[model samples]
Target: MTATVVVGAGISGLSAAHQLATETSDTIIVCDAAPRLGGKLHRLALDDPADLDQGPDLVDGRCGDPALPFTVDVGAESMLARRPEGLELITALGLDDHRVHPTTARAQAFLDGRITPLPPSNMGVPTDLEALGGFLSDAGLRRARAEVDHEAPALAGDVSIGSYVADRFGDEVTDRLLEPMLGGVYAGQSRRLSFEAVHPGLFAAARQGGSLLAAAQQVAAAAKRSNDQSVGSAPPVFAGLIGGVSGVITALEDDLRSRGVAIRSSTTVREIRREPGVDHGGRFTLVTGPVPAPELITADRVVLATPAAPTARLLRALAPEAATALAEIPYASMAVITFVLADAELSGSGLLVPPGELPTIKAFTYSSNKWDWIADRAAAGFGAGTAVVRASVGRFGEEQLLQVDDHELARRTLAEARAVPGWQSARPLRTRVQRWGGGLPQYLVGHRDRIQTIRSAVAAVGGIAVAGAYLDGVGLPSCIAAARRAVADL
Candidate 1:
């Protein structure tokens, strides 16, 4: 029987493997170093069994669309509805019922030892020069705006996002606003990220306007127009599961299994080799290990969906050109500490933090207040507000990831949170820590060219491909979409 070997049992791998099984009638085996699946898409049912949350809850992109779950995406909360791949998958999977939106509860960024509302301008683009900075001088803001272009650049070349931002807006904007914003997104230092790859739109806009500041103004106005159109939209919220973030995962995994998809957890694949055969070309062989020292399963194709580092290693022998290109991408480790408190604690909405606000906390999410899942628990409290707030330890590779243990991190977060006027009254009902050593992938400025080369180099190989958040967009929608793209090739 023809089979497909998929490395990494994460969502991307799993989804592609499932498609391979259904489309080609091929037996598919998904392998990962970890016992469980889901990659960065994690759902949790903490000490409170009733409440389910996304650690650092990822937000949903279909914030206003109905005909779905009215998804309250709080954990890892983000969606690139702009992308086509994910939306297509949702329709294919018949998850139209699962789609939904969560309440944003207003976002704010902390910097210079104070919390300020992040401008609600489109895509965080500054519409007016006055909106440039509490940090930059008037002249600096004007100069920065004069440099921005209004269109996004293509993936034809490579440039550091820092260089692009500096050339367009000056060093102050790059260091303070953009760097921190990107840090929160990619968890990598901006200097290393390529601007052409990461923010193509901003790059093009800068080129058009001769400055990012000017591009921001035009983009901001356009964005405002879009926002006005979406104002009275239905669901008008971010999407998530009815219970906790895990609810959807549990349901989806079980559904996949019901369709005859077998998930073998805690398994590892030592290596993938080509089996020379005349029956149907050369079959791809996967050497099973940690089970048998050298037992092998031959397959028709293979999908390398692991993180960039491991992917680089796997393709080294089969497609060295592709492997080397894959190796160029870098990763940043991250840790999350979740503090679930009673209603008496969380006084209001959530908060964001800009870069340079160090030594204590990086970002905090008012879980109980943002989504109905946690809010229901908060409402159940002793006539006061108790909520779950997540504190991220590192953005630009901070020491907190290495320096603090669970208790210490908790203590530090609690104390630092008190410094924020709204959350001072909040205390944890339960606490937990989730650390991802190589959790997030940083998209550097040269990222596009490097990835393009990697993809091109790998394409020369037959029946082999790669897909993940790192390849496409860096959000849930992107991940889902990437998985679908891999399936199309199969």
Candidate 2:
């Protein structure tokens, strides 16, 4: 049987391999440049391994207490509960029972030197103007009101979310509200992000007519009607696993192995050469090796589920047009600093900082307060006095912040935490900094058309498909859906 090769072992690649294993008779082999699986779904243990006293049972003060291992996910932390793809995969992997939802969905907005409750928003578009009087100036509120009274601008095709929103509501709304929420997810500036790609339903609503805020209200009303159904009320907005999101990776790997899928790690593919009208019709030659040694693996079908840049490089030979389009897709690097802090009264799930407000930290998650699983682990491993909090630092144009050493980054993150209420005097017991080089993909304007062109070029090459956070939505559900669709195309 001819083997099908997947060239990345991220959730997308693993999901593709798993789907192909079930749907097709073709042999599947997954390869990755990294030494371990779970590209971004990485977890770190809290206790020191070298300390003899620090075993799995290393609780801070209890001898016979439940010795649960304390681990913090440094990568993708949560999945959208409403998106069925991720949950479906979890159920298929027998991990549906381990699913968890946030205890508190509330979040704070740290802006203008104070932390206040984030008002109800439709993807960062505030529904209530009067409530926002504290944050917005009289002039800003007037501009926002003018958006509804003024005729909607003619948006023929895809446009940058920032530009469109700024034009509609004013720069204040885009910078103060939309940018933070969009930036927290994509790490890309809103001015460059595709409005259609990021917010499709809202985009459709906007196209109908009226202001952006009016569009949001209309879209939200329709959503409310849909949420009246059985499926919508079942799950929360976000959910995680009992252990960590990494559990999904482990489960996927085990399932793939059970189905006889060969997983190759620490193997980098130098190039992929498509051989047409050759032996057995056609096949792909994956030039893979560590160094000083080269190995060629032939595959009847190939899947490129890598990041934007590397994927572009691999496609340079087979499909230059696709490579060019892929090359234009840029990425942002970031660091997640996990701090073990003393138990403080931190309500709400997390806080998002407005852009240009903080130099180091962009977002903060009160892990223990947000997730019951994390809280239980913290109580079992350390005691009620201990808490877990993490701050995400770095954005698209903020590469300089990541240049400093991890120690300095952590120090800066802790200092930013002081801006949050009740965290002023909090000190971190242990600090763990995870640096992700080229972590998040930026979905700039024209991203949808570019993705279409890239897909068309790759499709012309035949027997090859590309899937990643760049093409699909930048979330676990979106990636899972993209991976499934990529494999189905074969």
- For every model shown, what is its TM-score relative to the native structure? 0.83, 0.94
Candidate 1 lDDT, 341-403, residue by residue in tens: 542344335555655566546577766666665565444432245455777767545544556
For model 2, the stretches where C-alpha displacement exceeds 4 angstroms are: 49-66, 232-234, 276-281, 290-292
User: What is residue 411's positional error in candidate 2, in angstroms?
Assistant: 1.1
lDDT for each candidate structure: 0.61, 0.82
Which candidate ranks first by lDDT, i.e. highest? 2
lDDT of 2 by residue, 54-102 (tens): 3222123333233456777999888997778988998999997888888
